[model samples]
Target: MNPPVPLAKLLPVPKDLTGRLALAGGGLFLGQWFLGDLLHVPGGGLGVLLTGAGVWWLSRGSTPPRFQEPASLQGWIARCREVLDQFETLEPDGGVRRQQLDAVVQRSGPQRLALVCVDPATCPQQGELEQALAGAAPLTLSVARPLASAEGARTWPTVLQEQELILFSLAAPLLAEDLLWIQQLPEDQPTWLLVRSTAGESDRHCSESLLAQLPARWVDRVLVQRPDGLLRDVLQPLRRQLGAPIRNLQDTRQRLLRGLHQQWQADLEQVRRRRFQALQQRTQWIVAASVLASPLPSLDLLAVAVANGLMLREMGTLWGTDLQPDVLREAAGQLARAALAQGVVEWSSQMLLGLAKLDGGSWLVAGTMQAISAAYLTRVVGRSMADWLALNAGVDALDLERLKREAPVLVAKAAEQERLDWGGFMKQSQQWLLHATS
Candidate 1:
C-alpha cells in the first residue's frame, strides 16, 4: 500500500477516538447548559444525557461525509482491496460455483430445457413439436415422462450421449406447488410453460392464473397453445424468442452453453446476495446484544468492532479472499469509524417517535436505544464492507492514499441506502425490543 495520506491533507475533523469523545463531551456540556440554564429544564444530569442523545439522533443524517472521487473504476476497486487486505481474509465459497461451472464446461453433448405444461390432457404430442423444429438440431430428440417421477431428475443427464438436449416433457399438469418446487431446482434450467386450451370445460383452463403466480422474471417465458394452431405455429415464436438457428446442431449447443453460463452466473449472484444478508442480520443482532451488555450505553464503536471484524472475515470467505486476522480488525476499525462519522448511532437513535408508539416510549429504559443503534451501525458497516468485497474481487489492490480517498464514499453509499430502508429496519427493531423487554 502507498504511504498514508499526510495528516495535514486529511479532513479537518476529529480523527481519533479520544478527539471525538472530547468533541462529544463538549457538545453534551453545551446542550446541557442550553437545556438546563436557558430552557430551565430540571435535573441537570438527566437533561445532559437526553440532550446528548437528541443531538446525536438529530445530527445522524449529516454524515459518512463525502470525499474526493477516485480517478478510475479500477482505482476505486483497488482502494477497496487495500482496505480489505488489512482486515479481510480471502476465502470464497467457490466449490459449489466451480462444480456447477464445470457441469457447463465438462458436458459436451445435448443441453436440456424443461417443457412444463399447465394442462397435460390438452397438450400436443412431443414428437410433433420436435418435428416442427427439425431444422433447429440434428433430429435426435426424446421426451421424459414427468419431472415428478422417480427418474425425472436423472432424465436429462442420463439421456443418450448422442442427444444434444432432452427436452423434459412432464406429462402432468403443473400445480402451483409444483411451480414453487421447480424454482428451487439446482439444474436452474430455462422452463417453457405450455398453455394449451382447457380440456373441454374441465376447469383446466386456469393456465392464466398459474402463469400470473410465477415470479415476474419468468412471466414472458410462456408458450400459449391455441385450440386449433398447428405445432409449427408454436415453434415459430419459440425459435424467434430464443434466437435459435434454423439449422446447425453446433450452433444450438453454443447457444445453449451461453444461456447456461448466463443463468448460472445469475444464480451465483443471487446466492451471494442472500448469504450476505443472512450474515449481516446475524452480525447486527450480535452487536446489539453486546451493546446491551456494555456499561457505556452511548454510541461507542467497541461493541461493534470485534463482531464486525468477524463479519468482514466471513464476508471475505464468501469471496475466496484469505485475509489475515490482525489486519482484519484494522478493516473493521476503518468501517466502524466511518459508520460513527456518518452518524449511524444518532441516526438509529432517531427512533424516538417509534419508541413512543411502543408502550408510551418506555423502551428507553436500560439502554435499549443504545443497543438498537449499535445494531443499526453494525448493519451499515457490514453492508458497506460487502460492497467493497464484491468490487474488490478479481482486482488488483491499491495504496493507503487511495483507500483514504474512497473509504468514506463507500460507507456513505451504504449509510444512505440503509437510511432509505430504515422503515423495514425499524420494524425489526420493534420486534427486538418486544423480545428483549419480554
Candidate 2:
C-alpha cells in the first residue's frame, strides 16, 4: 500500500504554472482591451499593468492560510520535560519533591491532622500516631471515631473541617453512613484511606471494597498498610499516590497543563480538517465560476470537465488514492453529461439571475448568472465524485452509467441543503487564482 499523503502536502493551494501564466497574460490583455478599447483610456501599457496587478491581487486573496503540521506526542512529552526542568531549577534543594503530608502541612500552614478509625481499639493511640507523623513541622494529631452513632456522625464533619489532612484507618467493613460521610466531604480537602485488613479477610479485597464504596474523587490517596510493617512504609506509598509530595499544587498544575496540551492538539487537528474541507469546496466553486464566465457554447462544459477532473484528482490525494488521469477524465465527462441532462444549466442560470437581481446591475447580471451557475454545477459534480470515490474505493471502479443516473438527485439534494454563499467563495477563488500566478 502507498503511504498516506501528509496533510501539509494535501492542503497547499494547487500549483499549475502553465495555467497561471495563461491567466496572467489573458488578464493583462483583457484589461488593456476594456480600458483602451471600450473606455478609451490614454495609456494601454498602464492598463495592462493594472490588470496584471488586479489578477495578482485576486489570486493572492483566494489563497488559503498556510498549513501547520499537528504537534506530535513526542513534542508534547518534550514540552512537559521542559516544564519539569523549570520546576527543578526553581527548587534546587528539592523543595518541590517533599512528602505529601509534609507539603500539605507547610503549604496549609500549621493545620491539625484528623485520623479516623473504624474500630477504636485497633487504631494506634493519638500520641504514638503523632510520633510517627513527626517531621520538620509538628502536626497536632486528633483521632476521629467511626460514624457508628448519631453523635459520631455530628462530630465527623467538625473534625473534617478543622483538619487539613484526614486519614481513615479501615479495621472493619465500612457501613453505609461511613461511605456517605466520605462522599459528603468537600472534594477540595485532601483525604487519605489506609486499609488495615482484619485477620480473616484479604487486604486487597478490603482495599477494593472500600474504594468501590467511596467516591474516587473524594479520596486523594489510598494506602495499603502491611500488617507487620512500620508506619514509615505507608508514607512512601502515600507520597507516590499524591503524585508530588513536596508541592501538590505544582504537581496538579503540571498534570492540568499536560491534559490541556493533549486537548489543544486534538482541537488543532479538527480545525485543520474543517478548514481543508472548506478550501476543497471553494476550489470547486472557483472552477464553476470560471466556466460561467465563458461566453462560448460547450466551452463552459469543457471547463467544468477539466476543472472537476483536477479537483477530483486532488481530492483523491486527500483520500489516499493515486487516481489515473484517464479514470479522472472519464469520471469528469460522466458528471458533465449528467449536469446537461438534468437541465442544471437552466436551473443554475435562473438561480444566478435571482442573486443578480438582489445585487441590482444589468451589466453584471449575465456574468454573475454564469459564475453562480458554474459554481452550482461544479458543486454537484464534486459531491457526486466524492460519493463515487467513497463507494467504489477509486476512480477505477466508478460506474459512469450509474453515476449519470444518480447525478441529478445528488444535485437537487445539494442545492436544497446548501445555500450559495457567493461573497466568501468569490473572495477565496480570487486569492487562489492570484497565488497560482505568483
Candidate 3:
C-alpha cells in the first residue's frame, strides 16, 4: 500500500465544486496508475475510482463550512445559528464547551456571557448546556454564587464588571440580603435568571416567591426550566435573549448616579437647613451687639438691615431660590420695622434685665437697653426671613399676620435651646461695630 496521506490534507476539502472534482479525478488517476501498472492488479481502475470517491466524500464531510463575518444583529443571529449547528456535534465536556464559548465571544469581540446554573447538583442538564455554549465564540463566563454571606457579597461587584451577560440559576429561595444585593447591581446589566423548579415545592409557588423578592425592572428576563426537561431545550431562548448587546458601563454609571441624585438632594437640604440656622443665630448676635455699640439710632437700624439682608439671601440659596439683593433688603426692612412696631424691643429689654440679674448684673450697663432692643429686632427679622424662604420654596405657607405672631415665639424657643455667650457676643459686636463705622 502507498504511504498513508497526511490526516490534515484529507480533512478539509476545497471551497469550490470544481476544485473538489479535480482533486477527486487526480487521486483516481494516481491510484489507478499505481495499482494497475505497478501492482498488476485486476479491476485496478474501478477500485481506485471507488477509493477516490470515498476520500472525496470524507473530505466533504469533515470540512468546516465557511461563514461570513456578522456585521449586523440579524447577521449575528445567523452566526449564532451556525455555531449552534456545530454545537450539535460536540460532546458534553467542560473543556470542549469552554473552548466553544470562547470562540463565539472572540468572534463577537470580548462579549460578556453569564452562565447561571440553577442548583447544579439537581440540574442534570447543566453539562449539556455548557457543552452547547462551547464554540469559537468569544465570551467570558462568570458563575455567580449566592451573596448570602460577607465573602459572597464581595464577589457581587466583581461579577458585574467581568461578565456582560449574567446567567443566573435560581434553584433555591433567595434570602432578603441576597435580594437586596441583586437590586443594588447596575440596573442596565442584562440578567437572565434561569429558575428551576424543585421536587419539594410547586413551580408556580416558587416562581411567585422569587418574582416578589426581585425587582421587576431589574431583571431582564425570567426563564423557567422544568426539572424533567433538558437544558438544551432553553438554549434557543437564551440565544434570542442575548441578541441585544450588553449595555455599556458608562451608561450604567449614569443611571446609578441619576438614581442617587434624588436622595443626595434631600440630604443636602438637611445640611443647608442646619447650617442656615446656626449662621442665623450667630449673625443675629453680631448685629445686636453692633447696634448696641452704635451711638446713632439710624445706624442701629442700618446695621440690622444689612445683616438681615445678607442672611436672607443665603437662606434663599439654601432653599434653591436666587433672591435678588433688592428683594432681600425689602423683606428685611419690612420684618425689622414690624418687630419694632410690635413692642418687641421693650419686652426684650425687660427679659435681658432679668437675664442680667441672674448673671450677677455684669451685663447691666448704660447701652444695655438699646443692645437688647437691637438683638431682639435681629432675631425677629432672621426668623421671618427663614419662614418667608420656606414659604417661597413651598415647604410652608404663612401670611404676614401669622408670621409676626410666630416670630417672638420662635426666637424665644431658639434662645431656650442654647445659652448666649455674652462675652463672645460683646467681643464680636465690638469688632462688627468698628468695621461698620469704618
Candidate 4:
C-alpha cells in the first residue's frame, strides 16, 4: 500500500502566491549575489526571470499527457506472450536438475524423511535420532551425518532424493548463518523443524521464535526437545505423519516445484531493488550536474523530466515489463507534477539560505543550493518511480489514472524516506560545493 497521505491534500499548485514570492525572492537574491559586477544591476532582472520561471513551474506544474497503451492488437498479444515468458522464468525448477525433478516424480516406496541438524552438537549423536524414530514404522530416516559440513552437503542431496519430507534438527544455539543458508533451500518440500533450544521459554514458545526466520510451514511440524533428550510430541505427530495410510507422491513433486517458483520470485525482487538503488545514485548525480551548469531551476527540472523518461524505461527493462515508451513518459510527467508540488526547490532554497545566515557559512552559492535540491528531487522521483513499478508489476496494462492516484503517496513516501538520509546528502553536497566554488 502507498502512504496514507491524501491525494486531494497534495495539490499540484502552491496554496498561496506568498510561498512562491518568498522562494523566488530567495533565488533572486542568490542569483544577484553569485553574479556580481557592473552587470550586477541587470543581474537583478535576470534573477527575477529565473525566480519567476522556477516558482511558476514549481507551484503550477505540468506533466506529459497520458497515452493509450499498445499501438495495435498484435502489440497487445506480444505483451501477453512476454508476460508468459516472465512467468516461465519464475518456475521453481529453474537453474536446478530437471532430471532430478523427474526422478523425484518416478520413484515410490516407503515414505522417507531426510533429517538435518543446523546447529551441530555431539551430545545426542545418531543413536538418539534412531531411537526417536523407532516407533515410526514403514518409514526410512536418513540423518545427514555432520550436516552443513562439506562432506554432508555434498552427499546429503542424493540420499535426500528418496525422501518426501525433511526435518531440520537444530541441536545447539541458533546463529544468523542458519537463516541465510536455509533461504536457498526448496520451499515446497514437506518440512518439519526439530529444535533443541536452550532453557527459558516454553517448548512451543521457543519453537515459534526459533523458526521465525523460516517460513511459517516450518513451525507446523515442529518437534521441540525436552530436558530428557526426547521430542515433546504428545500427539506422536512424526509417527502418525510417516505411518499415514495414504500418500500423494506427485503432490510432493508439485510442492518441490512450487517452492522453487517462490524462491525465484524472492531472488528476482532482491536483484531488481539493488539495481534500482544504484541507478538512483547515478541519475541523481547526472541531474545535479545539469542543474548546477544551468542555474535556472525550471530548465534544470525540464532536464530532470527527460532523465525520468530514461530512468523509467530502464526500470521497465529491469522488471521484464512491456509498458509502452509513451506511457512511461506520461507516467514520468505525472510524477514530475507531484514532485514539484512537494516544493522541494523552495524548501531547499530556504534551508540553504538559512544556513548562510549563520556565522560560518561563507562559501554557499545560489547554484550550489539549486544543484543539491535538484539532486534531492531526482532521488525522490526515482524512488517513487521504483515503487510505482514494484506495485504494478505484471499488471495486464497501464492505467494512467491509477498512477496519478498513486502519485501523492509515492512522492510523499519518497520525500519522507530521503529526509532520513539528509545528513548524508548534506555531507556529499558540501564536498561538491567546496570543489565547485573553489
lDDT minimum window of 10 residues, candidate 1: 57-66
Cα deviation at 120, candidate 3, in Å, is 9.1
Q: Report the lDDT tens digits of candidate 1 across residue range 196-268.
A: 5444532234545555566765565555555666767766655553343232334333444444334543444
> Which of candidates 1 and 4 is the stronger one according to TM-score?
4
Query: What are the Cα lDDT values of the candidates?
Result: 0.53, 0.51, 0.51, 0.60
lDDT of 1 at 225: 54
**What residue runs in model 2 are displaced by over 4 Å at the alpha carbon?**
1-276, 279-282, 288-299, 358-363, 394-405, 420-438
Per residue, candidate 3 scores C-alpha lDDT tens digits across 265-345 of: 344445556777687767777776775676643344446556665677767666655445545554454454344334455
lDDT of 3 at 54: 41
Residue 426, model 4, lDDT: 80
TM-score-superior candidate, 1 or 2:
1
Say which prediction, candidate 2 or candidate 4, comes out ahead on lDDT.
4
Candidate 3 whole-model C-alpha lDDT, 0 to 1 = 0.51
Count of backbone collisions within predicted model 3: 19
TM-score of each: 0.43, 0.32, 0.41, 0.48
Q: Candidate 1 or 4, higher lDDT?
A: 4
TM-score rank order: 4, 1, 3, 2
Q: Quote model 3's TM-score.
A: 0.41
> What tens digits encode model 4's per-residue C-alpha lDDT throughout 1-438?
223232235333343677556545644543454334211223436455664454344443233343333443344344444443554554433634444434544556666777676556622456666666676666666767544546434223544534677776664356665655556455545666666667665776776676676676566666777665454253268766766524635455444444333444455666678888888877777776776776444455456556655777888887776666766665665676676556554555566667768837555566556667677878887888888777666532456668778787788898888888877878878776666557
